[model samples]
Target: MRSLKKSLVHMLSVPLLLSLSCHSFADLTIDGKPAPHQNLSTHDVKELLADDDELELTPQGSTTASTTLRQSNGAPPAMHSGVVDTTFMNNAGPNVHAGSALVMDAQTGEVLFSKNSNSSRPMASITKLMTAVVTADAHLDMSQDITLEPIDFDGPKKASTKLRAGDKMNRAEVLLVALMKSENPAAAALARTYPGGKPAFIAAMNAKARELGMSSTHYFESTGLDPRNVSSARDLAILVTQAYKYGVIRQFSSTPHYDFNLGYRMLNASNTNALVRNGGWNINLSKTGFINEAGRCVVMHTTVNSRPAVVVLMGEPTTQARNTDATDLLNWLTGLPKDT
Candidate 1:
C-alpha cells in the first residue's frame, strides 16, 4: 500500500513540478532568454497588443505591410512607394466614399490627396485607357479598317455591344467608340487587330505599365472585364500623367459625343463620363468604368481653380457616390491656393 501511495505521489509531484516550470518560463523569449517583460508596464503591454491587432498580423505573428488606412473588399494593400498626402486622413481634404482614391498635380507629379491609394483593385473599363495608349504607340494606320469578329464578343463579362461580328470601322472610329462608350467589343477588336494579335497587345500593355514605373499595375487583357487587370490609384495617376502626353486619348476621352458612320446608319454614342458634358467643368481627359467587381470607377485630368490635377477614384458603391466624391474633390481643390 505504501509503495502504491509513493507512486501516486511521484506522478502528482511530476505534473505539479512541470506546471510550475511552464508558468515560470512563460515570459521567456524563443532563444530561452528572459523576455523584456520586466521593463514593460501594464499600459505598454496593452499598447503593444493593440498595435498587433491593427497590423493584420500573420499566424506567425509577423505584421503585413499596408498603405491603406481602411480595408476594402478584404483585400490587403499592394506594396507601393508613391508619395502620399498624410494630411488627407485628418479631414484636411474632401470627404469621399470611394474605397481608394488619389489626386495629384498633373504637371508636377506631387500628390495632393490620397486614400487607400496603394490598394490594387479591378479597374473595370478603365483598362481601355491603356488600350488607347498602346494603339497610339503602334502608330498603326488610324485610317485602316478593322472588321469585328465573333471572338470580339468574348470577354469575362460577355457584355453586349451594338457592333456586330461583321461590322467594320476605321481604327480611329473604333477607338472613339471604345473610349466614349466603354464598348468592350470595340476594345477587343483593337487588340485582335494589333500587329501580332491579342497576345502581343496584352504584353505591350504590361510593358507600358512597367515603363511608367507602375509597379502595382498589371494587365491580362485590353478590356477591364478581367478582375485580374488591377492597378492602384497612385499607379493609375502615373498612367493618367503619361496618357496626357497622347493627344488622341485626351481628345477621344474628353469628347462628349461621337457619331459613327457605318455606311448604312449613324450610331450615336456619348462619353461614359458625365462630367465631360457638364459644361461647367473644364475636363481635358476623362474615362468612366463599371463592373460588378470594380464598382463605379472614374479617372480624369481636369483643371480645378486653374490647377491641373489628375483624379483617380476606385471601388465606389454607386455612381452618385462616385460623382459626389469627384465634385467634392473639385470643390476642395478650388478652395486651395493656386500654387498648391
Candidate 2:
C-alpha cells in the first residue's frame, strides 16, 4: 500500500476518490478504566453516505421542515432559533457534496443550514483542534522543548509523517504543526508529553467536549488516527466557535504557511484547509482531516456577510468536493445581506 504522504500527492492529481474502506473502531480506555458509551464496531463508509431523499434542510429550533423561507424585506433574520430560515437550504443553498454539513452563527449558536448535521462520523485530524484546545487549557510551558520518540510514529493507521523520531521542537511549535499541517506525529508527541501522558490527555479532551456541550463528540487519542474519534457537524460547530476564542489556536490554525527549523533541516508546512491560503477568505480558525473511514472533513470559523460563521463539512468523498462545498457555502453566505 502506498504511504499516506504518497496517497495525498496522488489525491491532488485525481478528481475523485475511487474507493474507501472501514477500519474497526478502537476501544476506548482511560487510566485502565473503560470509557462509557464507546462503539467498538467498524463504522462502514457506506453507512456515512446518506441517500439524497434522506437529506433535510432544517434550522436549529424549527420543529418542522420547510422549503419556504419567509424573507422580511429582503433580509434574513440576523439571529433566530426554533423558526425556519432556509437561508442555506435545498435549492436555495449550494450543492454540498459532504454527507453531513452545517453552517451556524458563531456568536448566537444558531444553525442556519443543516444536512444530516446531527449524525456522528469519524472526524480524522480535525481531532487535533481539540487536542490543541486541551493542551492550551493545561497552561503548559510553550517554550519547553519536546523530543519526538519512536512511539510517536505508532498509530492505528501508521501513516507516514514528516516529523522524525528525534526531531526537537518547543511545545508551541508542536501544536502549530499539528493544527496547520495535520501532522499526526506532532499530535501524538503532544499527548505523549502531556501531564499524565496520552491517556490523561484523552480524558481531558472528552471532559472539555462535555463542558462545551458537545454531547456527540468523543476522543480516543490526539492524532485522530483512531476511527473512534467521532463527532457531528453540530457538535463541531460548537468546537469551532469555542476554539476560535483561543488566540494561539486562531493564529496557528489559520496561518497560510510556515517553515519549521528541525536544527538539521527545515520542514515547510502549510495549512490543511486550502481556503486559508487563498486571499479571498477571512478565516479565523481552520482544521482539516481525512482517513479512509472518515473521508475528507473540515471545520472553519470565518466571516461571512460581516457576521462570524462556523462551517463543518464531513464525509466528503474527495478534497475537491470538500473545497467546493466550502467555497459554495462561503459564497452563498457572502451574497446574504449583513443584516441577515
Candidate 3:
C-alpha cells in the first residue's frame, strides 16, 4: 500500500509541476532574470512596443510624418506610414479631381468598398468594355465579312483609325481590335451593322446598362470617346463584372500588346493599362481610359497579398498621379486585414 501511494503521488505531482513550469515561462521570459510577481522594467516595456514593424512600410528617407488622429491625453495617437485611409479618400488626391471610385467583390457583387461611387462622370473608352460584351452577346457571325462603308468613317466625331468605304474584314477580327486594341473605327463598324445604326445601337447599350442594374449610367456613344457618355463608378464596377463574363473580353483586356491589320496597314496595339505591362502587378484584367474631360483612369482586377483586389483610380491631374494612386492603394491593401 505504501509503494502504490508513492506512485500515485508522483503521477499527480508530475503534471502539476509541468503545469507550473509552463505557467512561469509564459508569465515571464527571462531577460536580466527579474524576480517573480514584480513589475516589468521600463526596458522590457520598450522592447514589447518595439516588436516587428507593424505597418510594414519604411518610407524612402529618414524624414518622418505623423497626423494628429486623436488628442486624448496620454493616449497613443493613430499613425500610418503610407497610403490614404478609406475615410478620407476624396481629399487625398488632386484638388481639381471629381468622380467616384470603387473596389467591389467580383463574385457576389456585394460592395466590399466604395468611394463616392455614385457620382456620375464621363467614362471615356471604358465604355468599350460594355460594347465588347454586347457585341459578343449579339451572336453575330464572327466570320461575316464587314465591308467598311464610307459612313463608318464619316461621322462628325474625329476618327482614331482610318477606314474607307471599300476596306473589308471579318466581324470577329474587327471586334478583337475594337476591344483589345480599342480601335475606334472597328467598334463603330460593329455598332453600325447592328439592326439599325448608331442611334439604335446606343439604345441597346443603354438597355444593357439597365439590365446590369446601372442606375446612373447614360450612353451617348458606343465607344467612350464621346465625353457625353457618363456613368458612376458604382455603375462601371457592374459594367466591368458583366464584361468579364465573355472569355474573350477577359483575355483581350489583359493583353499588353498585339499586331492588328487595318485594310491598308498593320499596326501594333498596346494596352493602356500600365499595370499589366508594368512589372510589379499580378493583373488578371485591366483597362485604362481617358479624354481631357474625363482625366486619367484605370480599373484593374487583380490580387494583392493573396487576396482578391480591385484598384481603380480616376480624375488624376497627371498621368503619373493615376499610377501613383494605384501603387498607394496596392501598398495599403497588402497591409490590410484578411490580406492573406
| Alpha-carbon lDDT, every model | 0.69, 0.69, 0.55
Task: Name the runs in model 3 displaced over 4 angstroms.
Answer: 1-98, 108-113, 154-159, 162-167, 261-264
Which portions of model 1 show Cα errors greater than 4 Å? Answer: 1-91
- Tens digit of lDDT per residue, candidate 3, span 20-87? 11112112111223223322233332232232112121111000112111211323212221222242
Could you tell me the TM-score of candidate 2? 0.74
lDDT of 1 by residue, 143-189 (tens): 56788888999887777677788777767668878987889999999
Of the two candidates 1 and 2, the one with more favorable lDDT, higher being better, is 2
By summed lDDT, which 10 consecutive residues of candidate 2 come out lowest?
44-53
Q: What is the lDDT of candidate 1?
A: 0.69
Clashing pairs in 1: none
lDDT of 1 at 225: 92
Cα shift from native, residue 254, model 3 (Å): 1.1
